[model samples]
Target chain A: MSALRLIARDLRLAWTGGGLWLPILFFLAVAILYPFAVGPDAKLLRATGGAMLWIAALLAALLPIERLIRPDWESGFLDQLAVRGWADEAVAALKIAAHWLSFGPPLLLATLVGAALFDLDGDMAGTLLGGLAIATPALAALSVTIAALTARAGGGAAGLMLLPLAIPVLIFGAGSLGPNSVGAMPLLAAVSLGLTVLAPFAAGAAMRALRD
Target chain B: MEQRQAEPAPDAVVIDRLACLRGGRLVFERLDWRIARGTLGLLTGPNGAGKSTLLRIIAGLLRPAAGSIMVEGRVALADERRALDPLPTLRQGLRFWAAMDAQPATATDRVLESLGLAPLADVPVRMLSTGQTKRAVVARALQSGADIMLLDEPMNGLDKASAALMAAALAAQVRAGTTLVLASHIPIGIDPTTTLDMAI
Candidate 1:
């Protein structure tokens, strides 16, 4: 019950804090601006637009990184929850789940509009959606871990820290866009699964380390 | 109220040969204390004397340089930071933790009434003055329903009347069998069964 309540609180915070809109707008802006930059050729836009959306999604994930874990940590909310017998891992897991909820769906929905702007056909759009389904959770997990690590340092440092870690998800997710991309799905799921499994523990440990 | 619905077990806090280090300097060493159920512990020390550090260690927020802490039952801490979300109204902020603690919503109302905060319950925490924020933190600690409470410098910004009100509420908690460990430089106005005085 408390876990649900915590997730609800996080979702509300994310919604009201502009967690949803910023990323969607950023994603759409990239799609809208790309056609002008590269030219009005529909075929070229169709070819590269999916990859561009992946990049935009990756950058959009960075927008919430700074506020994701730090405010609660600094405000003592995490410590308060700790003393209440809520394990850091549970808290980390819930925050990751909530982070994904706040960003993942909206970004996916925005991608449909992005697909239209980029003139992607049915097959490419389907592939883009599948890749995002596996990839965004991984992005959220990596961003959250980085958020925990640099929560105390508090600056663009977390953004810098997140870029390298996020590269794997980006590479695999974008790589999956090819003709034999079915093969890339499992590998994409593998990387996402690995990060998802490791993130809670890693982020939990980072939260504990903040006390020292 | 109603003897706090009975704890799962008798509560106790034991710290042995505790030592603390901050900023590469030894803050204190060889500290020892025990607080049993229904007791009020006063942690008194000069500034920079490690009172807050000891409370943090006891609250499990910090690791002691060397020591052992054995605590029975759930613990809650209230320090300089208000912990409650600043964007929410006082009532809303307190309710978040109340829900987290699995307490009914009325638990928050009871705490607010006790802390003289019912009138300002709709005020956003960020807009609250220092004294009001302190009261809000106390309200949160009281609503936690934990077996043990660790309070660090809880009286720092409270006015005399508010301090007296806080003292009364704490005394009531102690009467209801909640073990309290309070660290403060000012007089807490409640009789403490155990006092740990630290020196720099």
Candidate 2:
């Protein structure tokens, strides 16, 4: 019951706090800019669009990183919940789930616009959608972990820490869209699942460390 | 009030040889104290003293470098930070904690009334004055129905009437068998049964 309420609170905060539109807007901005940057050649746009979308999705996930855990930490919400018999791990897991819910689906919908803008064919579009579906949770997990790690120090350290760790996800995610890259999809799924499982523990440890 | 399983000890908290270290400096060492249930226990100290640190240790939010604390009941804390969603209405913010604490729906109203914040229920938390925000944090702690509340500077920003209200509400909690470990720099109205002076 408390778990659901926690998720509800997070969703409410995300929607009402005005960051819900940020990632979507940023995603579309990248989508709109990519074609202009590459010139309006349909073949070039289609060739590079999937990779561009992957980059956009990754960057979109990064947009809200600062707001993720810092506010709750500063406001003493985390301490209050701890006193209420909540484990840091459980809180972190719930946050990751909530973060993904707030981030993943909206970006997925925005991807449709990006896909259309890029004039992606059926096969490429399907690959793009599938790759994102498997990848965004991992992206969400990464963002949350980075948020916890740098919740105190601010955004500079977060970018420095997150970008390096995110290389694997980015590699496999973009690789899946390459022609005849049958093995890349499973690798992406594998890496993503591993991150999703480990992120809660990492983020939880960061919060606990912060308490000292 | 929600019923709790009967505790064996008359004391809600027992601190033995407690020590705290922050930033590689010893904040306090070998501190010993007992906070009896159904009484107000005051933690009074000068600035840079460890009153807030002791409360955090008692609340289990911070680890003590040495010694152990045995807390006998559910604990709640209302510190300098409001610990609430600033965007939500005061009532909505309190209701979230109430729900988390597993208190009934009516608990929010009752707590607000006790804290003299009923009129501010519909106001957004960010719009509240300093004292109102302090009262709201107290309201959140009180709504939890915890047997022990560790409040850091509960009366910090209150004016005379609001301070009186806060004192009255805390006294009422003591009368109802709730234990409070309060850290305040100012002398408060309620007569604390025991006072731990950390400055020494």
User: How accurate locally, in lDDT, is each candidate?
Assistant: 0.88, 0.90
Q: How far off is each candidate at the interface, as Cα RMSD in Å?
A: 1.1, 0.6
Which parts of model 2 have CA positions greater than 4 angstroms off? B1-9
Q: Which stretches of candidate 1 lie over 4 Å from their true place?
A: A180-182, B1-11
Backbone clashes, candidate 2: 0
Clashing pairs in model 2?
A: none
Task: Provide the lDDT at B119 for model 1.
Answer: 92
Model 2 residue B100 CA deviation in Å: 0.4
Model 2 chain A scores worst on lDDT over the 10 consecutive residues at A11-20
- For each of the candidates, give the backbone clash count: 0, 0
Evaluate residue A19 in candidate 2 and report its C-alpha lDDT on the 0 to 100 scale.
Answer: 60
The ten-residue window of minimal lDDT in model 1 chain A covers A176-185
